[model samples]
Every structure is written in C-alpha cells, then in structure tokens.
Target: MSDVSRLADRLQRVLARAQEERTERDELVDGPDGTECAWAAHERDQMWKAVNALRADDGRPSIPLDDIVQVERQAAGHSDYSRKFALYCAELAQK
Candidate 1:
C-alpha cells in the first residue's frame, strides 16, 4: 500500500483495538452510564489531539500519541461504544 494508505490503515487498526479494549473495561468496571459517557468523551479528546498532531505542518517525524500515550491507552480501555459503532467510528476516523 501507499504511505498515506498505510498510515490510515494503521490508525484504523489502533482504533479498532481501542474499541475492543473499551468494551472489556466496561464489563470489568461495571460503571454507570454517566461514568461511561465521560470515558467516551475523554477518548474523543485524545483522538482530536492525535489528529491535530498528524495535521501539523512541521517536518519532524511524529507519532500522534507519543506524548500522551498513557492517557490515550487508559481512557480508551474504558470507552463506551458497542462493537458495531466502534467499527463504524474506526472506518470514519481513517478518512
């Protein structure tokens, strides 16, 4: 695949994996809807941060989550999406 396509594919994989982890967390923690909602919001915040970094004009090589990787992973492990929606979001995020 071309470079951009490869990058996008990798991102999709990351998102899909994040979704799976999130589902597991919800099951393990037994959090209420409000807590789950907050977790989802935080996950989106991390995603936007990553996207902005990816869109930056600097020439330096970067990985979007390299700085806040811990937050990204932890928050994602508790995201509240159902499997279908998570897959849908992953598909959209790639575009």
Candidate 2:
C-alpha cells in the first residue's frame, strides 16, 4: 500500500482504540478516587490529544472532535478528506 494508505490504517486503529478506552472509562462507576477509572480516563485524554495533534496542519487550526468523527466517516474512501487525514497522521507520527 501507499504511505497515505498506511497512515490512514494506523489512524483508524488508533481511533478505534481510543473509543474503546473511552467506553471502558465510562463504564466504571464504583472505583477509588484515582484507580482504575482514573487511569482509563487519563489514557482516553492522552489519546484525544494525540488525535488532535495528528489532525493539525501548518497554518490551520486543529479539528474538533465532532469534525474528526465526520472525517472518520469519510476516511475509508479515497477522497480529499482521506488524503488530508493521512497527511495529518503522517506529520504527527514523524514528530
């Protein structure tokens, strides 16, 4: 596959894992002050930051979570959104 294709795949995996972590954190209802739920929440937050950084471009603002979701919906195809999303992932990964 091409570099953009590879990066898009990686982005998809990362987004999926982030969603899973968010769900796991939300499911926790009776944990200690800073235990299981806290750890998951922290992981979720870090994942979100990573995603936001990945989506940022030079001279452009980072995309919000809602927009990211829309991009995700369109990323499977070889559209302009997919190309930009792949480029963003590549830029972030190189850093």
The stretch of ten residues in a row with the least summed lDDT in candidate 2 is 30-39
CA RMSD of each candidate after superposition: 9.2, 9.1
lDDT of 2 by residue, 1-95 (tens): 87656766776566556546564455544322334454344443443466566546433465444444344344436566535554555444443
Q: Which one wins on lDDT?
A: 2
Runs off by more than 4 Å, candidate 1: 21-36, 57-95
Candidate 2, lDDT over the whole model? 0.50
lDDT scores of the candidates, listed in order: 0.43, 0.50
Which pairs, if any, clash in model 2? none
TM-score of each: 0.36, 0.37
**On residues 11-63, what C-alpha lDDT tens digit does candidate 1 reach at each position?**
55555555555543443222322344444444544454544455453443443
Backbone clash pairs for candidate 1 read none
Model 1: how far residue 3 lies from native, Å: 3.6
* Model 1: lDDT of residue 68: 35
Candidate 1: worst 10 consecutive residues by lDDT? 27-36
